[model samples]
Target chain A: MLKKSGTTLIEIMIALFVLASAMIPIASIMGYGGRATSKDARRILAMQLLDKTLRQMLQADYDEIPIGKNIQNGFEGIALGDVTAGQDKGFSFNISLDSEYVNPVKFKYRGVGVNRPTFKADSPVGDDFLPEETISLNDVVIKLTVTVTWNEQQNLPVSVSAMTYRADFQRRTG
Target chain B: MHYLDAKRSGMALIIVLTLATGILILGISYINTIRKQSGRNTIELGAIQADLLAEGLTQIAMLKFKEIPGPLYYAYIAHVKGNTSQPYSVYHGDAILGGKLDSPFNAEFRTTFQLLSSKMYQDMNVKITVEVEVSRPDGEKYQRLIERTVSGSRRPAF
Candidate 1:
């Protein structure tokens, strides 16, 4: 009347069930972490692209910079491989160069004449100073913005941007 | 027969306990590694943001410089001509241009400009330094300094 020497079918099934249950939560956690890491990587890529494009725009001549927003399919020179039309590795690039007039700073040459206007005037220079000259300083400054966006997992949209002013003292379109 | 059945059940229980402990330890370590990686990523991103903020602020400072070119040029001339009083602060003060940050990025900046070369009749070469202090919602703070040399020539009056 010896009993069985090994685990019964019921015991084995219970063990398997416990192990499977434990692994399920662990698998989900790992999956979540993997997705987060991927999102971080894509964000980094988008940031780099935004920075590079912004710098390029800064270097361009102010007049050469096209005013108004322009959108492109994707970034170039990044070999992410085989992107479909209208999307480059699931990223899009946008750039805008906007120009606006700035208030003129009225400056007066403190003398009776234009040349060598620095002389100490006999009369109050404030009253007898040369006519205030208005220089169009706004033409030299342009607001440049570069942005990159991508659809993350679950169709969640993420973006990175860099903006700065591009000034060209030589070109005065105003 | 009872003794044999009890022995088999005990061994099965021991095996299951050991496997469960091992799996838990592995999962905890894995989670810990992922957490550390995420932290590092956040730090890297913050650094990039700080750098870009500093640079953008520098550009704004340059625009500020451009705005007062006439006054700055005259002040430089006066300083060179034995005027002991330097009127730089009158035209461009500390924090030349500030307070233009967009949402989600909190930063404060202090800007200072030094006249590197004021050679007569030459463009005034100014050294602009921008100091930025950035604070993120995640309790991370970063400070950055950026220096740029810009040549300022007074624009002709139209």
Candidate 2:
């Protein structure tokens, strides 16, 4: 009589257990990949929105810059789109104008006004930006920021910011 | 004895099949995630390009003003040459290169400009128009519009 050398119940059970264990890591990798993709997409949108708003400001007229023109806080409120409350987008922006004497910025805040490519102090201002200095003129401060929020539960919002100011000085024309 | 082994072999086959099914489901979900990500990239690229074009539009408007620059309706319109404008297409949103996306957004500006002289400062209200036609690499088209009014004065500020 010819007898077959087939496996028993215990042996087959052991093989399956090993196979499932081996597949665990592969399943985890797939799960991680999905979350990473969503994160990347949101980040890209934030960058684009921020760039769009900033470009508009840059293209504005030299005089149109946010200097003493925060009239009725309109320029300050121009940071976000809609006029009143309940018109909130995913972001909001504001600009404020006051004598550097009221609240001295830059010269001490960010250490700007000295970096290269610095304008030769041509345009005129009201109060002296660097109070310690002699010239007294108006200083324009521009504060820009973009905040992005997802509609998901408890998801933290992301933001990008830009801060720069125009100093007081008259550029002697040729 | 042969019957007992045959049943054990069948049980193992079923277990293996079940695992394969789980793997397929996971694979499909992962692919969906990637596609969603690609769609977002398209919007971001479109937004940046649109803003750049808008800046150009603003500068052009400032250079040339209408006799009666209505601060309400001055802006630009960007669209594909062959096809009319549509809203959003995930496929076509690349405005970085000078491709079809750039072609549709031709510059159409106002002719007359307000001239401000010294002594008499007038409230100059001008309308500037800017349109961004988003062209994506994957053969899609999109457009965005911006309407702005600019008020200019003659005298130097205080």
Candidate 3:
């Protein structure tokens, strides 16, 4: 009888091939996870900075809202001090203001009856002929737009914006 | 006997394949779990930040309201209401507090007070709303709105 031998080299090679195939995908997945986590962390930091800037804007006086062109390193024309040097240090932002008063609408009442008795006389009369109109409310309505820009991973640019409205209304006096 | 040897080798091959597959599945599952956890954490952090900002702005507005006298406060309201075209007076954080930090992040805040209703010889109620927007150096933005209602005497008792 012939003596039985140990496993062949071919078997060892096949086993290694299977193991390598399985490990390759797993390693790639882990690498993907690491990169995603890093990106998310940067995003969170950026969001925090944005929130802080917005809070500062809300604390400002209404009349002092910077309007028209972008205002840099200042709030309402006042120097922001060292905050404006954000670019040199890490981050920076711009605030722009656009304002307009909302217009009120008015409806005119037209007589239902026409001068002529004919049912289809020329044109319809009364309310049918009335036209809708818009009038200015004369109240101050201001829109403040704030944009913040920063860099991610030291290269990619990231930015976020927020807008709010301020309208003037009557105040009661005792 | 040859048939038995062949059967044993086939069994070994199946066992090895099964073990490899199990490890692969587990690793993929773990990675997916980690990814989900990170996403959840980020969202929670954002929500908390927004809430804190809104609360802070409300406090600042309340403090400003306390500092001004009633007559002047009323006048300020009138001016803002009457002049729709011209810009109204606004408080600047750096200017009011002084010695503000020079940070890379920038912030702009707008607070407005609206008189709700009032009666002569009675307390006057006003609604104060604060809007804030913050910008980061990387161009990220966050915004919040805070509102409060406060009542004060038309004229100071003192």
Best by TM-score: 1
DockQ of 2: 0.04
True-vs-predicted CA distance for residue B95, candidate 2, Å: 18
C-alpha lDDT of all candidate models, in order: 0.58, 0.39, 0.49
Model-by-model DockQ, in order: 0.25, 0.04, 0.07
Q: Among all windows of ten consecutive residues in candidate 2 chain A, which has the lowest summed lDDT?
A: A102-111
Better of 2 and 3 by DockQ: 3
lDDT of 1 by residue, B84-129 (tens): 2234444444332444354557777777667676652446788888
- Please state the error at residue B75 of candidate 3 in Å: 23
Rank candidates by TM-score, best first.
1, 3, 2
- Model 2: per-residue lDDT, tens digit, B1-158? 76765565556656666776677677767777677776766655554555555454444334323221221111101112212122112112222111332332232222222222211134555444555565555655556566666555544454
lDDT of 1 at B103: 50
Query: For model 1, what is the C-alpha lDDT against the true structure?
Result: 0.58
Provide the global lDDT of candidate 3 against the true structure.
Answer: 0.49
lDDT of 1 at A23: 83
Tens digit of per-residue lDDT, candidate 3, span A1-174? 233345544565677788788888878887877877666655555555556555565556666655564556566434332233233444443333333322331111122223445423222322222232222333333444455555556577765554433433222222
**Over the stretch A1-174, how does candidate 1's per-residue lDDT look in tens digits?**
223523465577777778787888878877877877776677666667656666665566556665555434223332221222233555443332233322332222222242555554222223223443333444555655555667776777665555565656444334
lDDT of 1 at A124: 24
Candidates ranked by DockQ, best first? 1, 3, 2
lDDT of 2 at B130: 54
